[model samples]
Target: MKPLSPDVFDAAQALWLQIRMFAKGMLLPWRLNQLLAIAALFLIAHFAAKPIGHWLTTWLRKRQGWTKWKLRLGILIQQRVRVILFALLAWILVAVMRELTWPSRSQLIALAASIATAWAAIGFVTRIIRTRLLRRLVRWFAWIFATLYFLDFLTVAENLLDSLALSFGEFRLSALTVIKAVVVTVVMIVAARLFSRFVTRKLAKNSDIAPEVQILISKVLQGVLITLAILIGVKAAGFDLTGFTVFTGALGVGLGFGLQKVISNLMSGFIILMDKSIKPGDVISIGDTFGWIEELGARYTSVVTRDGREYLVPNEDLVTGQVVNWSHTNDFVRLDLFFGASYRDDPHEVTKIAINASLSVKRVLAQRTPVCWITGFGERSVEYILRFWISDPTAGITNVKGQVYMAIWDAFKKNGVELPYPQMEVRMLRANRDEENAPHFQMTTSLKD
Candidate 1:
């Protein structure tokens, strides 16, 4: 074999020396003992986790007086009970071991405990996250960071990421900065949304507050919280606020041009809420869409029609266009209907029957009562107008009208009130004198009601 080059020989010798040093360190009595301790602890944790988790779940189930959300949280804990138990066990054992011996002797156990604790926390949080992809990303990110931290390489990684950066004027952007911004922004925004929902629900339950007022207050609170969240997130991400002044100015200009309708809709939402003209469950008619208000969004209003179709109408349209609010100030609605009877029927008796028929409908308001009057006498029938009041418009207008009409038909049939149909007559005459003298018999024909 040819003689080795000096560079290769030196590299091999250095590698061997490093290997020897590593072997020597591992051979240390304390190091070997700690390795054995860690292996034993792993076995203990693996076997003990199941029974302890079971016991915990059983105990939690047996408890009384827990709120629904509390019970839900308990269920989440129980699902991660294995990791929790392991974390507790490792911490307790490692603490006792550290006290009895040198703390450094139990470094492996301490590392394991830290990792277990982090994993348990991540497990619970990831489970609560609704998105599957997000949950997986968070889990992996947390595990990598925790492992890096325990291995003492987190600072090195951070420094490496920080080095990969771009500079513009006085501003610098890096992988670390981007990651921090995203994480901080997501966390703060999620917290804001959760808090907004909780507070909104509380406001909704307050009986003294009007529904529109509740909606307005909740929306205002949400807007404030989200704004604060964005600002705080940017601050936490280590950006220079002074440098962002130009960026914000440019952003405002972009929004003004690109989002004119969007901004209008948002502002319109606030106006709608403030004016108290419409609220949740109010029957409204906008152009072709007719329904009760289901919810008020920043950009749109949810209207659920009687046909079960939900239309998301833009808030700007609601502000600008005509909206017929049936239940604006009161539940009473006066509906006018036309009916006719034969001229033979007494107008007074027919009026009483029609009024009773309208009142007999379940939705017709008894306190307000129904009124009927003869409008005019047609050529063959008496034309009358029927008017009635309904307190619950949201129940539906068309259906109630049909019901009242049916009730009227039934009452008319029972009371012998005749509903007349059109009658027509045709007479043919011959100009001849002979035809005029020959007719003792004349034919008459008419349509019956």
Candidate 2:
């Protein structure tokens, strides 16, 4: 026998040759029989899986008085019943082949059956994983592992992966190490997200916790958990964290310059939450954007306007720019409207009519009663201010104000109170000259009869 080359590929090839030679040494007739038996088993399992799965699903669904656990089990069976049935059949065939004395052929048949069983099981398990990307990833790795195991080349594959190394500064990483780190990190991140959702739901159910506090706590926990997950994954991958101190310093510098606004928004969000200045459901107006707070996030606040437009306002602007919180402290908001009536109408009577008109609006809060006051006396009309209160600002401030104005119009027209408009008066005069050098005064007029 010739010695095999020292290269990894050469060694793998040599191992494959040895296995093939051993298999060829088995009895030709018995090997053919085993092959035929394995083929028949596969065909039987394939043909039978669907009908058996359908029957099991129907039975499970038809059962009465099913508990939550039983219902979940039934759903699981319904989803993967075919795969489960096929796996069972393969495992049984593998057991039957194992009891045979055909040595090489029996081992080969059993290995194939075992691989089929493992594939089915992997499919079943991966189906339960919710994330589409993660499920696909898991399936790929599972098949790769099964393939290596069946070929008896798992150790050789591991060695090959480890031999492909890259050096960075004082540290070195192999393909295997990088893959482990990525896989572990992804798994931990997904787990953290799931746990965060669970905790968020639990916290939200507690009525005692303020909404801002709940949001803050949830965000903080998520950040800490994800950070921990990354660090743990890196450590598990056998990398030295100390080597990245300089890199981290550089990253901080980059963040300071490039992410200044991002950091400012994050801090501003925390400040808003801590101060309870702005929160979800608060009707606010910033610059031209007038809307209710739909959500408060780390970087931005979602403001949904009455026109059905949603604007993402950066948290920094909310903190620095002028903001009108209509529902702050309480939902009751007082609105002031100014109108003028002709000076002919009595001021007292106009005030009374205005108050009554404001009161006619359904949104006007009765407990805080609307009041009308003489704000000023204008040249053409008597100016008055109507102060009214509304309990729901989010229903809209402008809409209610318009309603009040409309009610006032109806009231004024019915009561014969006329609205004033600008008017101009012209006067004519004649003067006589008293002195000899005085200029003559003249009036020009044209008349038609």
Best by lDDT: 1
In the range 115-158, model 2's lDDT, one tens digit per residue, is: 76677677766665688988889888988899678867677677
Q: List the residue pairs that clash in candidate 1.
A: none
Q: Which stretches of candidate 2 lie over 4 Å from their true place?
A: 1-139, 146-151, 168-170, 306-310, 374-383, 420-449
For model 1, the stretches where C-alpha displacement exceeds 4 angstroms are: 1-65, 92-106, 123-143, 190-209, 287-290, 304-311, 340-348, 373-383, 420-447
Q: Using Cα atoms with residue i matched to residue i, what is each candidate's TM-score against the true structure?
A: 0.73, 0.72
Residue 173 C-alpha lDDT in model 2 = 79
Local lDDT at 330 for model 1: 90
Global fold similarity of model 2 (TM-score): 0.72
lDDT of 1 by residue, 320-425 (tens): 9999999999988888888898777889999999999998888898888789998998866898999999888888888988998898899999999999886766
